[model samples]
Target: MRATFHLKTLTVAIAAFSVASAASAAGLDRSGQDVTAFLQDGLYAEAVYTYIDGDVSGHDNAYIGPDKKAYEQGKKIDDIAESYDFFRYGVKADINDTFSVGILYDEPFGAAADYSGDNNFVARGDLDASVNAISGGKASSAADAGLKIGQLTAGATQAGAAAANFAAQAQTATTPQAAAGFAEQAQAAQTQAQTLAGQAQSLGAAVAAARAEAATTGEGTNVEVRTESVTGILGMKLGENKNFQVYGGPVMQQVQADVALRGIAYGPATGYTTHISSDQDYGWLAGVSYSKPEIALLAALTYRSEIDHSLNIDETYPLVAALGGDPVQGNKIDITTPKSVNFDFQTGVNQTTLATAKVRWVPWTDFAIVPPLYNEVSKRSTGDDKGLPLVSYDEDQWLVELGLAKRLSPALAVTGTVGWDSGAGDPVTSLGPIEGYYSAGLGAKYNLTENWAVSAGGKYLWFGDAQGQIPTKTIVSDFDSNDGYALGVKVSYQAK
Candidate 1:
C-alpha cells in the first residue's frame, strides 16, 4: 500500500512544471486553474513561488510626420516591463474515506509597465506634446493663413494685369492726370503682392517652432496592476469503489490598478492619472474527478465562473483644470473576469512511467473594464454615442499541454513538457501587450523523506509578434520575436 501511494505521489509531483509553463499564456492568466488541480486527494500541503521576466523592444514604424517617427530606430527600450513574482500556498486533507477539503491562496492576474529611459519615445514627450502642438489650432491656423494668402495673390495678380492695360492706355491718353492714375495703381498692386507673401512665410515659421517645442517636454510613466484570490473547496466521493468524486466552492478576489499617463500617444488619457480598486468580489468553481487505481488512471474536469466587481474609481485629469473644468472625478465602474474550463488527465504507462495532458479554455471576449465617468467623457469628446471601455478582450483563449514523467528511483522523478496557447488576440491592448506562446518545460522532484518532498521547475516561452492598440484600433507599437522565462520552486509535506 505504501509503495502504491508513493508512485501516485511521484506522478503528481513531477508534473508540477505545468504551472510554470502556463505563465506565458493568455491575458494575465498566470495560474491556469491549477488551484483546483492542487486540491487532489491526499493529506498534503504545499507552497510554490515563481518568477517571470520578459522584455519587448522594437521601433515604431508608424510615421508621425515627414521629420519625426514614432520611436526612432536603433533606440532600444530595455526593461519596459518589470519582472514579476507569484506565490501560492494550499492545504488539502481527507476528513474520511468519502470526504476531503482544501483551501488555496494565489495571485491570478497582474501587469506592470514603465517608460523611464531618455530614449523612450513616450518619456521624451513625443505624444502629448505632439497633440498639444498640433491639436491647438496650429494646423487650422496655418491652413487659414494659406487660404488668405492665395486669395490676396489672386487679387494682386488681377490688379497688376489691369494696371498694365492702363499703362498701355496712358501712353496714348488725352490728359496727364489719367497717365498719373495708371502709374500709381501699377505700383500699389506690386506692394500688395509682396505683403501677402511675407505673411505666409511668418505663419509657416510659427508652425515649425510650435512643433519643435511639442517634441521636447514629456516625462516617463509607470503603471501597475495587482490581484489577490482565495479559494475553498470541498470534495465528496461517490460510486461503490469511491472512484468518482465531485468538488466545488466559492472564490474571493481583490483587484487594484493605477495608471499614470504622460505621453501624447495616450491622447485624452495624457496628463491623466486613473485608479480603481475592488475587494471581496465573489465567484464559484465546480468539477468532477474519476480515477481507477487498478489502471492508475485519473481524469478531472473543472469550470470556474466569472467574477463581477463594482469598483469605485478616482481619476485626475490635469488638462481639465486647464480647461476650467473639474480636475478630479469619482465614480463607479463594473468589470468582469473571464470564465474558464480546465481538463486534466493522467495515466500510468507502466509502474515507472506516467503520461499527462491538460487543456484550459477561457472566454476572454466577454471580459471588459469601463470606468463610468471616463467612458461618458470619452464618448462625448469623440462624438460616439456608445463609449468604449478602458480595456477589453477581443477573442477567447486556449492552452494545451502534454508531458511525460518517469521515476528514476524510489525517491527521485523527472518530467518534461511541451505546450501551446492560442492567445487572447493578435492586436491586443497596450496595458498587457502579449500574443500566444510556444513553450517547453523541465522539472524534477526529490523526496527527502517518506513525508516531505522538494521540487523545482523552469519553462521557456517564445511569444508570437504582438501589436499594441489603443481604444480606436490604432496600432501604437509592435513587439517582434519576444521571449520570456519562468522559474518555480515548490515544497510539500504529507501527513503520515
Candidate 2:
C-alpha cells in the first residue's frame, strides 16, 4: 500500500527549508521564492523568520595599484560578512476542489557587508599619519619621512663637495705628510657621502610607496541592499481527478541600496559611492504542479519574471570630479532584477518516510548596476564609449538540495538536508567575496494541536574559496575556508 502517514512531516520540513536557504545563496537570492503553500489541499497559512550569519575574512592582495610593494605582507582583513535576517508570510485557501487563491510575502533578494580593521579596504589618513599608509612595514608618516630624506640628501651633497675639495688639496700638496693628511680627509668625506646617499635611496622608495597607498585607498568598501516582495496567485485544478494544476500571479517588489567602493582593489575607481532610493516595481510568476496524495507525491515547476525598476539615485566619484567630469543629479537608474526557476519534488519512501529534492537557477550574468556618471567618466581612461557598469557578475547561479523527512510519532516529525549552491562566479565582486557553498541542515516539527504546528530548523554552510576583485576584474583579495550558519522558525495553521 502507498504511504500516507508521512505527509505531515514532509510538508513542514519543505516549508521550513524554503526559509533557511537564503543569505548564503548565490547572487542575492533569498527565501527560495517558494510557492508550495498554494499546493495544499485546503486552507493554510504560515509565518516564518530566518536569521543567518557568515564568517567571511581573508588577506589583501600584495600587488595592487602603483604601490604594488606596499601590501607585500598582505595585511589581514577583518570579518566583512554581516549578519542578515528576514521574515516570510504565506496564506492559501481552496475554493471547492478546482480553484485556489493564495498570497505570499518574503524578502527575496539582498546583500550586506562591511570592511574594517587594518586592511587596505579601509580608508587611510595622510600617508605620514594614516594607519592604512603602509609600505613593507617600514614607511613612516609623510612629514617625518620627507624631512628626514631631505636632510640626508642635503648632507650627502655637502659631504661630496667637501670630499672633492680635500682630494684637490691632496693633489696640490707640497709635502708627503700634508698629502697623506689631505687624502685621509678626502677618504672619510667620501665614505660619509656614500653612506648617506644609500640611506636616502631606500627611505625615498618607502615614502613614495606610502604616498601611493594613501592615494589609492580612500574609503572602506561596503554594501547593503534590501527588498520586499508580495505575490498573489490563483491556481486552477485540471484533469478529472484534479491531480494537475496551473497557476500564476502578479508580484510586487520594493528595493533600495547603499554602496561604497574603496581601496587599491578598485584602483582609480576608489572613493565611489551610490545611494538608490526605494522603488516599487511589478513582475509575474507562473507554474504547474502535479500531486498524488495517496502516495504522498508532489512535483512543481515555477518561473518568475524579472522586474524592471527606474530608481532615483545619489552618486559621488572623486576620481571623476577631480578629472572635470560633469556632476550628475536627479538621474534615474534602470535596473532589472534577474529572473529565476525553481523545481521541487517529494515522494513517500515508506509508511513513515519521504524523500525530497529542490533545484533552482538564476541568470545572474544578465544583471548589473551601472551608475551614469561613473560610466561616463570611465571613457577618459578607456576608449570604449559605452563604458562599464559599476557592478556585474560573470556567471549564472544554480542551487540543489536533497533531503528526507521521517515521522517519529503521530504529532512529531524530523528532517535533514544537504545542499550546494553555485555562486555567481569565482573572483567575485569585492563587496561579497565568496564562490558559493555546501550546506547541511536539520529541522523538527511538533503539532501543538490538531490544526496548529510549530517548526524550527538550522543550517551550517561551508563556503568555497574565491578571489575578490574590482569591477575592472583586478584581483585584490583572497578568501578561503570561510563558513556560516542559518536558523529559522515557523508557525503554521491548516484545515482540510
Candidate 3:
C-alpha cells in the first residue's frame, strides 16, 4: 500500500518535469549553441541566423492494489515545436594592434508549449480509491483515536467523583434502594469509560500499522521528471591579439515547473496536472579564452553563476470536484538552478583539419524542491493540513564532444561531430536532455572578398532514451524522446 502511494507521488514529479521542459529548453542553453567563441575575432559588422526543431514523448502506469483491481492504464504524451529561430548581429573592432572589443545582441532563450487534452488517457476508480483509502484512513483513524481517548479519560474522572458523592449520600440516606441506584449508575459509567478506552487503543494500533504499510510500499516505483528554464544573453568582449579575450555580461531567465504522479489518475479519469510558474530571474556569466593562432590551438574556460527564483505553483485535481476530494490552491516554491564550469578545446590538425573537445560540470547536488509549500496551500484551500510528502533529488553529469572540420576550398569548410554524455537518470530531477547524444553537421565560409566573408551550416541531433524507477512497484515505463535539428548562417566583414 505504501508502494502505491509512492507510485502516485512519482507520477506527480514526472508530470512536473514534462511541463517544465519547454521553459528549460528555451533558457540559457538555447539552440544548444555553445557558440560564443565561434563568433569571436573572425566577424565585424555581420548578421547570424539559426533555426531548430524538436520532438518528445512518454508513458505512465499506476497501481493501487496487489490484486490489480485498482490501477490506471499507461498513456502517451507527445510534443512537437519547430521553426524556433535565434538572430545576432555584431562588430569586432580592433584597438591599436594589441586590443579589441566586440558587442553582440542575440536571442539566447525561448521555447514553445503544447499538450494534448485527450486520447489514450485513463483514470481508474481503484486508483483514486486506493489513494483516498490510504490517506483518508490514516487521518481519520488518528482523529478518532484522539477524540475517543479524551472522552474516556473525562468519563473515568466523572465516574470517580460520582462514586465519592454516592458514598457520602449512603452515610446520610435512610433508604437502601436509593443508595443502590447510585451505585448502579456509577458502575454503568465505569463500563462506558472502559469500552471507549479499548476502542481508542484499537484505533491507535490500526493507524500505526497503516502508516507502516504505506512507508514500505512507497519505495518501489520509478518516476521521470523535468524542469523549465528560458534565458537571453547579451555579451561584450575586451582584449587584444584576438587570441586572448575576456567576455562578461548579464543573462535574462524565465522558468516554469509542475509535479504529478506518473501512472496515477485523479478523478474517474486519468492524470491531471499540478505545477508552478516562476517570475523572471536575472543572472550573469564571466569567462576568458586563449588561442595560439601561430600553433592552431584554442581553449576557453567559463563560469556560469546560479540563479535563485521564487515560483508561483498551482495545484489541480479533478477528483476534488467529482468525488468531493480535498481542495488545494496555488502556492509559491523557492528553487535554484546550479552553477557550472565549462572547458572547450579546439586545434587545427592540418591546413584542412580541425578537432574540438568540450567538458561541462554542473553542481546538481545542491538543489531540491520543498513539498511543505504544497501542504500550506492545500490547507488554506481545504481547511485541513494533510500535506503531501516531500521528494528528494540530485544530479552530476559529464559530456565529451569530438568534431572534425575540413576546408573544401579557401571559401568553404565542412565539419562533423560525435558526442557522449553520461549522467543521472530520469528518477532524478534536473537531469535535462544531456542523457546521451549523437550528432553530425557541415558548415561553409564564403570569402566575398579579402575583407568580407559569409558562413552557413546545419546539424541534426539524436538523443537517447531516459528512464527512471517508480518507488515501490516493479512497474517501469519509457520516457522516450528524439533529437533536435538546427540551421545557422553568418556574415562578417573585417576592418583593414
Candidate 4:
C-alpha cells in the first residue's frame, strides 16, 4: 500500500506542474507584451511607474512700410510665448513566460501661448500717421517755398534793373522828381522781396528738418493671436506571444485659444476687450504589433484616426458694448484635429543590451477650426480671415536608442539607455510646437515570486531650438527650450 501511494503522489505532482506551464504559455499570447516590457522582464518583474513634463517658447517680429519715406517699424511682434507641459503613465502585467498585457496613457502633442503687446501692429487706432503726414507735408511746404523764393528773387532783380535804367534817364536831365520817386518804389519793392525770400527760406529749413526726422522713424499696425492646448490619452494592450499584440483606447483633449491686438488698451470708453475662452474635444486610437524573439527583431505599427470636434466658444467684450457699445456677439466653432502614424522597431544586441528605433508622422495640415454660418453672417463675428493657411506638414522623423542592463540579483535587475531624435525644426502653423533632441532613461525591476513581477523607470529628454511662423510676419527667434522628464511604473502577474 505504501508503494502505490508514492506512485500516485508523484504522478499528481507532474500533472500539476504541466498545467501551470500551460497556463503561463496561454497568458503570453495576449496583447500587452512589448519589446521594452520583455527587456524589463528579462531583468525581473517589478511594479513600475512613469511621468513626463516639459515646455516651449519663442517670438516673431515683422517690419512693414507703406512707402520709402513712411515705413512702419516692426509691425507684427510677439515675445516668447507662455510655457507648456506634457505628462504620461504606463502599466504592464506578465501572465506567463510568453504572454503579457499593459496600458499606457500620455499627452503627445501641445501648443504655446503668446501674450506680449509691445508693437501697435494688431490694435486698431495704434497706427502712427504723424511721421507719414508730417513728412509729406514738409516736402510740399519745401516745394512751395522754393517756388516763392524763385519768384521773389527774380522780381527783385528785374525791379533793380528797371530802377537803374530810370535813374540813368533822370541823370540825363528830363524829370528828376519822377526818377527819384521811381527809385524809391524800386528800393521798397526790393526790400519787400528780400523779406519774403527770408520767410520762404525759414519755412524751407523747417520742412527739411521735419523730413529728416520722418526718414529715421517708422510706424505701422500689427496683430497677434495666442492659443494653448492640452491633450490626454489612455491606451490598453493585450499580448499572447512574441508574435502578435493589439492595443486600442480613447482620449480627451482640450484647447484654450484667443486672438487679441498688441499695443492697444481696453476700457469702457475704448469699446475693445479681449476674447478669452476654452474648447473641449474627444478622440481615440487602436493598433497591433508583431515581434520575433528568436531573430531578435520587432516591428510595431500604430494608426491614430482623426477626431472631429465642435467648440462652444464664448466671446466677451467690454460692458460698454452692452451699454450702447459697438456690435458685440459670441458663438461656437467647429474644428478637426489630424490623425497620425507611429512605427517603432527593436533589435537585441546581446543578453544584456538592445537597440531601438522609431518614426512618427502627424497630419496636422488637415486641422481647422471654423465658426458656424450664422456667426459668420453676424457683423460681430471675429472669424473672418482667421482660418489657418494650408501648408505642407508632412513630417518624417526618426529616433535611435542604445541600452545596457545588469542583473543585480536572482530576482532584481537594472537598465540604462540613451537615444537621439533628429526632427524638430521650421514647423508649419502659427502655434505648432516641435521639439527634438537627446534622451536618457533608467529602469529597475523586481521579481515578487516565480509568477509575479514589477518594474519602474524614469527618462529625461533635452530638446534643441524649435522654429515656426507667426501671423506677425516675424520669425520667432531665440527659440530654445529646457529638458523634459518622464516617470513610469508597471506591475505584472504570471499564471504559470
Best by TM-score: 2
User: What digit string (tens of lDDT, one per residue) describes model 2 on residues 1-496?
Assistant: 4336446545543435555756545778777787877777789998889999999999988652344323343889988999988999999999888999999999889999999877768766455543223332333455666677798899999999999999999999999999999999999999999989866654564454344446655457899999999999999999998999999999999999999876545544556688999999999999999998767899999999999999998987655443455444447899899999999998888777778899999999999988887777666445588887877888899999988877778778788889999999987888888988999998888888878888888999999888887666667788988999999998989998
User: lDDT by residue for model 4 over 1-496, one digit each (tens)?
Assistant: 2111221111111111000000000000101112233222222222323333544444332322223222222433444334332323344555554545554443344333444444322223311332222233322444564565577567756655665665565566457777777667666655665665554444443333333323322322211222222222222334655466665556565554444322221111122223335555667666666756543455777766666656665443332233243335566566565666666665544443344554545544355444332223222212454432212243434445555555456567666767665542444333433445577777766667665656666667776565443332223233455455555655665432
lDDT accuracy of residue 14 in candidate 3: 11
Clashing residue pairs found in predicted model 1: 125-218, 127-264, 128-264
List ranges where model 2 is wrong by over 4 Å: 1-15, 65-73, 128-219, 326-328
User: Candidate 1's residue-wise lDDT over 1-496, tens digit each?
Assistant: 4234344545444546544754845776777757543445578888888998877655443334323213333334455667888888889899999998898888877777776554323535443335333333333444554565567567767766766776687787678998888777767765665555444433443344333324345555567878888889999999999999999999998888887655544544555578996656999989999987755678899898999888889987654543356769988777788788989888777777788888999888888777665576567445678887777778888999898888888788888989998878978876666787888899988888877878888888888777766665655566778888888888888763
Model 1, poorest ten-residue lDDT window?
Answer: 65-74
lDDT of 2: 0.79
Ranking by lDDT: 2, 1, 3, 4
For model 3, the superposed segments whose C-alpha errors exceed 4 Å read 1-39, 42-49, 62-249, 256-278, 311-331, 367-393, 428-434, 449-452, 468-476, 480-484, 491-496
Query: TM-score for model 4?
Result: 0.49
Q: Is candidate 1 or candidate 2 better by lDDT?
A: 2
**Top model number, lDDT:** 2
Clashes per prediction? 3, 2, 40, 40
Better of 1 and 4 by TM-score: 1
lDDT of each: 0.70, 0.79, 0.47, 0.41
Error of 3 at 347 (Å): 1.5
Q: How high is the lDDT of residue 160 in model 1?
A: 61
What's every prediction's RMSD, in angstroms?
A: 10.9, 11.9, 14.5, 19.1
